[model samples]
Each structure stands twice: as structure tokens, then as C-alpha cells.
Target: MTTETSPDEHQQQEIRLALSEIPSRLEALHFVTADARTPATVPNHQGRDEPTSIFNSYSPHLDNITNIALFHNEDQTPMPSPDEIIISQRGRRRFNNGSSPDSGSTPLRMPFQRTPTKVPLSTSMILRSSPRKRLTMGSTPPEPEPTVMPSPTKPRQRLWRQGLPPAKKLRMIEEGGKPIAQLNEETPLSLLLQGMSQQQLIRLIVGDLVAGDAETELRLRTRLPMPDINPMEEELLHAKRQIFRSLPTSRLCKKTDSSAYSRAALHLNEFKRLLTAHTKQLYDSANWDALLDYVTMAWPILRATPHWDSATHNVTRRQCFKLLACHCLAAVKNGGPLLGMVRLQATDKNLRDWARDFDDIQSCQSALSKAISKGRATL
Candidate 1:
């Protein structure tokens, strides 16, 4: 990092700084035996003070010094053992010298043929640019008359380019399928809450950042399930790093041309998907207890975004949390209030309370309709 050093030299300098510590380590180890006392502190003539134990590394100083000197060489770099040094310079890691007799460099491309094997191969190998349509012979009982079975080469499996894409491929025409994304497409964070003014987006990102764990904890710790403070730290860190709003601060978010709100919403949506994946992974791994922990954290996020009440009718943080919670629960096949609310009626237990609670949804709808009418919030 010093101004006097070039980039490579700077890297070497950093390595040297690390290497310089090796001698100090050797010196520190040297004193381990020298400082050892006798009787209680230092071992007796037969090392009886420690005979009942095996804690002592009692190699003599001459051997220890030789080992240290060999390891921590004059250059201060830890010198590897002879075998290791040979392996490092002339073993598996050694590369082709390009001038070995009767040898040329490996071809940039190699051709292969399949033999009913499912061995992993490059996409290009499977989907070669062939003028001839590939066809596979179909097996069927012979007909009375001679006939050719449809041998349309099993439509060669589609191949997607890996690593750096070829220029020719990009130049090729687009056909019917999912639209490919551009290399420079704006991310969700750059679109959603990023649409708001910088301060507004920052505030929203804060909510977003907080919303994940807050809603999850709030839902999980409900009277309906177990409660614990152990997971709170996990939630806090998740919020601090990831749950923050899609647009924390920048002109791009608030500008009319930006997709500030949509971007944030989309990110929240994807996070919900991630939770779903995590739930599945946990279930597959049979981590039932951990699954419950995640579920406890997740449920509240769903309830927070619920359109169940008018309190969250506006583009409310409560609603966002509810939406997230519902998505997570739904993803797990653990259908919760989100999917059941509409069906609840007078016949249901505590129907009056349910009806009262559902009123929030109606109120929220009304406010949303108003917002749309006033052009205050995007639907």
C-alpha cells in the first residue's frame, strides 16, 4: 500500500508483513520450554510433576531450534518441507511447458459422442451446431407392411452457453421463449422504493431492512407459539444487512423515471422466495426444530402485510410485512390466515371478532382506491 511500491510490489509487501510474524512465533515457542519451572512449575528429574499427564512437548532445544530454523527460513518465509517444496514446484501443479517432444497444446475445443451415459458434459457437446437434424430410432412392434418409424433425432437438448458468452450467440436472433435479460438491466433495489425521494427511500429501506425479522419475530412470538429471545440477534443482523429498503439513498430512486417502489417490492418478494427455499431445505434435512424457528420468525412477516385491515390499507409497512408472511407460509404448504380469511364467516368461532378484524381489509381497500384516484400511490 505504500506509495513507493507498484501493485505487485505492494502485494509482495503485504505477504512480507505476514511472513515477518513467523520469527516471532518461533521465538515465542522457544521460550515455552526455557521458561518452564521445576517441582510445581518446572518438571522434576524424571518429569514426575507431569508424569501422570502428557501435556509436555519435551523435545530438546537443539532439535526444536533446527525445526524452527528449517521452517522459518532466513527469508522469514516459512520454508516448506522438501517433499512439499517439490510438490509445489514440480508435481501436480506443474503446467505443460508447450515444448515437450511430440506434444502440442490441447485443442481449444474437443468433440465427444454419447453412449447412453449421463456423464456431465459441456452444453456445446450436447447441442452442437449441426445442419443435420438429430433423430433417434423409436422401438415399436413391426407393422404388417414395411414402414419407417419416425426417427426425428431426439430433439437435441437445448444448450445454454456457460462462462463468457460468445459474440456470435448474442448476435443471433431471438426466438419465442422467456425474454433474456440485458446485461445492464436495473436490479430490483434500483427500481422499487428507489422510486421515492432519497430520504423516503432510505426510510423505506430501513423498514424493509427491519421488516423481515421484525415481522417474523412478531409473528413467531405470538401467543399461539413458543417464544425466545435467542433468535432476535439473527433477525437484527438480517434486517441490518438485507432487509433495508430497495433504495436507501440516491436521486435514482425518487426520480419519476425510476422504478423505486416496484424495485423494493420485487426484492421483498424474492426474499420471500428465499425463505420458501430455506424452509424446504430445512424440511428436507429434517431440521424440524430449526424449521419451527424459521416459521416463528416468518409468520409475523405475513400477518404484518395482510390486507385484512384498513390500518394497513394504505401502502402500509404493516401490509408489506403481511404480504411477506403470507408468501412464506403459503410456500411451505402451511396455509395460514392469508389464504383462509375470505372464507371465514358468521358461522366461524368468534365470528364477530373476525368480522371486526376483516373490516381493516375493507378500510385498507377504500384507502387504496382513494390513493389510486388521487395518484398518490401506484397500485
Candidate 2:
């Protein structure tokens, strides 16, 4: 106690003391980790020992927690000793060796190089290997046998040749009334008409007796005079005829060309306008049947030409409205239900819209109910 310690000795003694405290520190850490609430003594940052709750005294490091969770077994059993782990690894290697190569348990083995064996040549083999010999100028080649061509096929007999007369003979018969000559498949109506006069033709068409003298029969046949048509009506009829003829042809060509379809649509619009004007006149005159017929004819044309401009579409809707209104009035006058007429002419969606467009929903519903009630009452 009286001797003074050298600086080097003092330093070594301090290091020993610090090393001696490591076991206590580790023991305290173990207890703290085992139970966070366990009381433990740990040195604070100020180098003073403090007794406190383990979790409060020493916070667990993230690395230590991660290590404990990762290495810990499900049953909390102790880890295997080093010798046992090494033996288990060896056992796994042995087990993998017995597993199927496709199971991916074993590494692929290097393939061995195989040396090819040489085969000895024989006399037959040498002969087979030699080039084949071909016929030379000295050899006499046999002449090929002459081929016999099949006999020319017999001309097929015509189906009409058995009993029918020739086309020329039939034409002669038709033109000159030859009793001996009969009709062949080739005889045409034009040829038959060639022998008859206009009066005979008229008599034939009228289904009158042409057996009597032609002039007398013609004089006897009653003829109705054609009605006179005004220039405007005639022009309208011609335009309607042209449009009717053009519609079918346009429908056929519309698939190949858009312009054709557009032209067809334009023609349909014009036709609709003419029909609308005509139908209005017919409506004013109380010609419901004629209006119905006009509507029926126009429906097919409208359905055929699908591409319609806004103007055409509006006109079509208006036309539908007028037609429906006329039909309703006609039905009411005839003591029939408007509902039946509407159902017959248009679809449900159109009926609903037409009802709304012509009248309010409540009025339409009431009208429909009255029409239905009337229909029931009549029954």
C-alpha cells in the first residue's frame, strides 16, 4: 500500500478489472433479454451503476433481436453442437447422392470422351463403294414398246335428239304454223309471237278466243280507254318508277362503293319527300287505304337504304308520326283499337316515342287504356 505503482502497471491493472466486469455485463444482458421486465444493474452513460427495470436499464439491440428470432427453433430447443451439425451435413450429402438426377439434388457429372472404333474394310464393301457403271456406245439398248392410244370416245347423244325437232325447224313451225314440226327446248316466246298479228296478240293477252277470224275477234273484244294523267302526275309517276328501279340496283352496288350508297340515300330522301307530299293529299282526301299502301311500299325502301343524313332521319320520323296518326284516326273511326293498329305498324320503342311525341305520357297512357278497354268491350 505504501509503494507507488508504475504507469504501465496501473494501466494493465485497469484493463484486467474491465475484463473482469465483462462476465457480469453479459450475465445481466442475458437475463434482460430472457425477460424484459427483469431487474438488472447496468452502467449508464455517466459511468454510474443504476438498478432499474431490465427494459428501462438496457434497451435490446436490433441485431441481437434479429439473431435470436432467426436462430431460435419452434420449440425453443438449443442449437445443435458443431460436431452434430457437421455429421448432419455429411448425411444430407449422402442422401442427395441417392436421389434422382432430375430431382436437382446432385450436381451434374462431366461426360466421358468416347473413342470411335475403326471397322475393317472387306471385298464386298470395297465393291459397293466403287462407282456404278453405265451403258456405253457399244451396248445395244432395247427399243420401247409402242403405246396403244385409247379409241376416240363416242360422241354423246343429245337429250333432245330422240323425239324433239331441231331449233331451226321449231322456229320455222312457230313462224309459219307448220303442223308437222313440234317445239324443241330452244324455241323462244319471241319466235312464237313472230307469227301472230297485233290483234291476235291482244286477244291472247286478254285471254279471249283467238280461234275466230282475227279482225272479228279483235272487234268483239271490249277495250277500256286509258285515263288521262296531268303533266305533274305523269312526271311524278315517272320519277317514282325510276326510283323504284334504281333502289334495287343501288342496294346491290352499295356494298362495293360508298358513293353509290350515299346516292341511294339521297334518292331515298327525294322519294320520301314525294311520298310525304302525296300522302298528305291522300290523307286530306280521307284515302286511308291508299296512304297505308304508300307507307307499306316506302317502308321497304327506307329499311333497304340504311345510311340517312340528319335531315332524312328527321323527315322519316315525321313521316312515321303522320302515318301512325292517320292509322290511329282510321282505326278509331272503324271502331278498332289504336293500340292494335300501332302494334301492327311499328315496334314497341317506336310506339313509346310516337306516343310521347304526339301527346304527353299521361294522355298517351290514358288513350292506350281506353283503346284496350274498348277492344275488350267490343269482344
Candidate 3:
């Protein structure tokens, strides 16, 4: 050169040259992007002074290459433009509408603020409900909850009315043939009851049937105290007699109506009361002889009573026999040699065969036999 160029002028000339190459480079980029699905071939757009090729020097994709720098090399990574750099420095950029970064119409965005939507609280709660957690691979699953079983309920018990005769033909409820005791006549009523607890008095009245006269019966019906009569074995015996007298005269059959069935049910109810209250007392006191006597008296009556009904099962009769067998079993286990004598008498009377009538009683009978065997061993 005839004249030496200044440093500032030289820089200005290089910038102009690079600016002039931008249009052609951009055109080449658009052409490559437009036909990106097909393989791109090198373009012949570079000037003779520029020896290197853009294809050999840079990646083909616009997303992988940036046009911000005036110079680039084979190993150089892409850098953001001025707008992208500014946005990136501020925060992550969000597009209001989903658009590519190359789209000129797409504006540089700041971080978006999430405003609350105008939805009801209930609706929002439903929408925001946490999703069920998914089990991951190789993780153990949760154990299932234990299965609860319902307990079997007892069958409904039949009710017995006061003073109702066992048979339609019988005129009145029998008070057994035994006379009411007059031993406590000199004692005050309070003193007579003083030795006994309230529970004992209640058991005597409700269970023992100590009341023998019409006045006593009336008071009992009215839930009044019968301090006049003392609790005695005589009253218990009379109650037992009343139960025996109440046994059904005939079995319930197809010809039997509702009213007849009802009367039979009442009789069974009385027998239940005898088993629950009076027999329990006899067992508790270890009154072996009296217990044997009642069993002897009851066995024949039970054998005579109706064991089945066409309209219903023989549950009541079966339950009564089961109670008798249970008492016998308890006495056999606890009463020692006395129960052996009772069992011998039962065997002579052929009463053990009666156990065959009820499944529950058969079980008790088996237990009774085992208990008797154990008692003999102990002796």
C-alpha cells in the first residue's frame, strides 16, 4: 500500500466487511433450516478472501449456532444474542404463546406471575386434591387390613306372663303342694331381710317365688317388697313345682294355631326361669340331694312336654335340657362321690338316653361322662 492505514480505520473496515457477510450467511441459514429434513449441501456464498467454509467450521442447526460474534472456530460453542443475554441475566424467560426462539415476532419475556383464579374454594380443593402415590419398581407393597368377623347373636327368648295356667283346662297356677313357712313370724321384716343383701332379696322374690298368698303375688306384680315371707328352700321347691305343672300337655302340630303355640311358648319360658334361677341356686349350695330330686321330677315332665312345633324349631326345649345337663356336669365335676350316686340313679331311670333329643345336651353329657371318669380317678 502506498499509504499506511490507521488502527481505528482498519477496525472500521473489518466491521463493515463482516456486516456485509451477514445477509448472505442469514440466507444460507434459512435455506438450510427450510430443507432441514433433507441433507444440507455446502453453499458457494463465501467471498474469495474468506478461505474457510461455514459448514466445516460450525454446526448446521440455528438452535446450535449463534450469529452474535464476528469470529468463530471449530471448537467454539454458541452464545446468546443481546436480547436473550439480557432476559437470561434477569430470569428464566416464558413465552405467553408457545413460539420458537427464532420467530422474530416472539417478544423477550420476563418471569410470569401466577395470579389466583376466580374459582370457588370447594372447586379449588377438588382440583388440587393430591393424586394417589404410585408404587415404585422394587419397592414392597403395603399389607392389607385385617378382616373383622361378626359374632353370632343369641336367639330371641320368649316371654312368660304371670298367673297364666299351663293348660287351658287348668283353673289356676299351682303353688306346689308345699306349705309356706311360718318360722320368721316373731322376727321384724327389716331384721329378717337384714341378714340378706338387696341382691339376695331380689333373687329370692323374682327367682325363688317366696310369695304364696294373693296379697304377696299382688305386691310382686306391682314390684313391691314382700318382707313378710322369708327366703327358704320351701319357696324354691314350690317354684320348681310350679315349673313342672306348666309343662305342655300336647305337642304343637299342623292343626295347632297361633294362640295354642303362644301358650306352649309361655310354659317353656317358665321352665327357662326355673333353670336360670332356682337350679343355679341348688348348684351353688351343693344341694346334691335336692338337685337330684328336682332333676328326677323334671326329667319326666321334660319327656312329656312337646319337643317340636310345626311353626318353629325346638330351641326352647333343647335349651332347657342343655341347662339341666350343664348343671349335672358341674355337680359331677364338683360334688365328687355324691354326683356318682346321682349318675347311677340317672342311668337306672334311663334319663341319659334323653340327651339324644338335643345336640347341645349330648355335648354336656359327654363332658359329664369325662368329669365322672376324672372324679373316679381322683377318688
Q: In order, what is each prediction's RMSD in angstroms? A: 44.5, 30.8, 21.6
Whichever of 2 and 3 has more TM-score, that candidate is: 3
Question: Pairing residues by index, what is the TM-score of model 1?
Answer: 0.20
Model 2: per-residue lDDT, tens digit, 1-379? 5999999997777566655665655554543443333335566432345223333433565346434644442544555876675455444244345455565843322122122123342423321211212122122346589999988999897967677777663353455564531445477778867888867777776565646567765676545332222443544555545544654464355432445444455555575566557656656655444444443444333333343344544455456445545554453344335335454333323446545454432233444455556766665
User: In lDDT terms, how accurate is model 2?
Assistant: 0.48
Worst 10 residues of 1 by lDDT: 107-116
Instruction: State the weakest 10-residue window (summed lDDT) of model 3.
Output: 129-138
What TM-score does structure 3 among the candidates reach? 0.32
Among all windows of 10 consecutive residues in model 2, the one with the lowest summed lDDT is 126-135
Candidate number of the best lDDT: 3
lDDT of each: 0.42, 0.48, 0.55
Tens-place lDDT per residue, model 1, 1-379, is: 6566678986766566545554654555443432223311322224444222222344364355545544544434554675664344432333456765644633211122122234343444544333322322122334487778898788665365567554563635457544333333575645544456857754654565446677754664463332342454355335423534544468544422234444455545555555555565555554433444454455444434323123322344444344433333332233222223322221122222323433333323332233334432221
Largest TM-score belongs to which candidate? Answer: 3
- Give TM per candidate: 0.20, 0.24, 0.32
* Candidate 2 or 1, higher TM-score: 2
